[model samples]
Target: MFDLNCNLRRGISRHYAIDKITDNHPIVKSSKKRIDKEYSKFAGILIDVFYDYLLVKNWEIYSDTIFADFTTEIYQSFQKYSGDIPPAARQIIGCMVDGDWLISYQHLDGVENALDRIDYRIRAKMGARIKLVDAMLILQRESIDLERDFHAFFPELQQHILNFSLG
Candidate 1:
């Protein structure tokens, strides 16, 4: 069952975040443009924060699957800072072990708004763009791995997600 109000695209996994694809909401449309403009600033912060974590976590030398996954994650995070794009928007991050798309497309409107607000604050504080793509890539890759492992280890948790509210 697809939850249109939530971020999930129809027929995808629970972890998916199908963001305003083919959407026509006026506010969301406007935010999309602004968010795209400031991705560098937000992505940069994510990269820097994740880079530090990578160094401490010692995942600098990750597997190709993991690295590719991470790289894709950073690429997708551009939408995150894009205020118009919902937090639950589905992103094509990497391949599952089986080669299907490992995507995230569930959006929490509140969470998405909060992230947008944070991005605004960061941009205002810095007064310039930030370029932390390297760090963001790593962080996203690791997160994907974490999600995969988590779901694998606790399949039962899916039930809770299914019942969660999108609003």
Candidate 2:
């Protein structure tokens, strides 16, 4: 099994995780669902969406990219219940670097999207907040020492990420 220790960051109830890839215990288990109400779902989706981009850019995902790619969900996770309850899926990001898997998550608190039929059980399903300025992340990967460059380059996303946490 892949060691999951030291692969997570949390604020209040929010979290970001970077998992070392493993063939023994795949980071994305075979018993999980695509729309499962877990926060990690968000991580899974993000890595997939950006897999080609990450590869084309040639950024070595350390044992710490916090995002990985695994494209298959032909199985069911543990949380599947007997009753046909409404699905409350969360958004997460996952990717691969040097064959290591990374995962990122955002809690679904204070989300502007109203839940019409979602129950409290799955309503707390945390996910990433789709930001308007994520288009600039492509530039952030250009350098490990992207200090002032990002601050000056992507002030909008930097501010939004900070403000979202504060607000």
The top-ranked prediction according to TM-score is: 1
lDDT (Cα, tens digit) per residue for candidate 2, span 1-167: 53222212223123221221211223223212222244334433333233323332333431234223321220121122212223332111111221122221111111111121122224456433533123234323422323232223233433444565576
Give the residue spans of candidate 1 off by over 4 A: 1-121, 125-132, 140-147, 153-157, 164-167
Candidate 2 residue spans exceeding 4 A from truth:
1-69, 73-86, 90-131, 134-142, 146-167
lDDT at residue 83 of model 1 (Cα atoms): 50
**How well does candidate 2 score on lDDT at residue 153?**
26
Each prediction's TM-score against the native? Answer: 0.21, 0.18
lDDT of each: 0.37, 0.27
